[model samples]
Target: MSNSASGMAVCDECKHKFQDLKAKRSFRFIVFKINEKVQQVVVDKVGQPGESYDDFTACLPADECRYAVFDFDFVTDENCQKSKIFFISWAPDTSRVRSKMLYASSKDRFKRELEGIQVELQATDPSEMSMDIVKARAL
Candidate 1:
């Protein structure tokens, strides 16, 4: 767990779990949240393997900020199977300003700890990170 100058620390469990998702295929997605009391980023929820994207999205609180990683698998034009890891910053408009600011500020350092993210998404609303947008970015 590395602590950035901003006083945000990435908990060890966060890194280990991400490695499991990225390399071991242990989870479909992982949701992360900052523990304001400790100023540390921690794993809040994990979508089990075989969980649909909708399930992953459902795990996010509509009125809070969260960071998540999804393992997206799709077929290419050549019919080749490929998977892309996405790092998403979810900050709904209804969330508190302080929460949003903390998440935004802590994102980079937290993301760096999880090594293999291939794409990044910042979404303030569901429309911004719709499946269509994710697919376009994946391709």
Candidate 2:
């Protein structure tokens, strides 16, 4: 990852650092449970370059058939491409604000704030990304 993209390096168990393989780019996804349903959001390259959340969300499955995966043309180099998955599940209590009662009322803002996970593990991968989950956070 570029110094400006990720900002800095961090450890695996550490939510503050993100480590990607020699791959020119990196991607991260944080999942939240909204109204007992799973609402996934992209966390990698969070504040980096080349793609927008709308563009990333576009790649997600539209069928609502348990998953949706799409690839963005957001390639850093000819060899570097980044994409994310947003999985949906039904359950009201399965949300980001599940524990943060202070931010519970502000669901949207709270969900966005609790961005601390990798891509959805259960999402159907038509093209296996083999993505190694990278934690994204600031410390």
Candidate 3:
């Protein structure tokens, strides 16, 4: 079994063949629960290499998602061609200033945010992704 930074464990013999693995690229999905329904905002491309939170904020809408997930594309040390995906999600403390309450009230902004989140996921293997896994990661 291999342990990830998020404390997730996966026991895949094929994935463990290599000792070293690192993320070559990644994308962030921010999820929000509004009106009892969950929505998402996906940040697909960063404006610059090593973009900071400020850059992310500029791209982010005034509102925030209660949950977020980061999907990373990792390459094996033995063969760069051999790759896999790792997903990690988090829930931030938004009690201060009532971040959720301060969510953008603009309909257009919400529409755009939802659109971004609806973009296709970066998983190479579609079978590996499922709503159950996503829900588990959100916890």
Question: Which 10-residue window in model 2 sums to the lowest lDDT?
Answer: 130-139
Write down the TM-score of every candidate. 0.96, 0.21, 0.24
TM-score (C-alpha, index-matched) for candidate 2: 0.21
Q: lDDT by residue for model 2 over 1-139, one digit each (tens)?
A: 1123222222222223222311233433222222222232222223233555454444444332221222223344456665433322212233234333322333333323324322333333322322222112100
Quantify all predictions' global Cα lDDT against the true fold: 0.92, 0.29, 0.30
Supply the TM-score for candidate 3.
0.24
**Candidate 2 lDDT score at position 92:** 24
Instruction: Please provide, for model 3 over 1-139, each residue's C-alpha lDDT reduced to its tens digit, 9 standing for 90 to 100.
Output: 2122222222232122111222233233222233322222323333333543334334433333322223332345554543232321221233334433323232234332222222233221222234444333333
Candidate with maximal TM-score: 1
Q: Model 2, stretches more than 4 Å misplaced?
A: 1-25, 28-49, 65-139
lDDT of 3 at 133: 49
Of candidates 3 and 1, the better by lDDT: 1
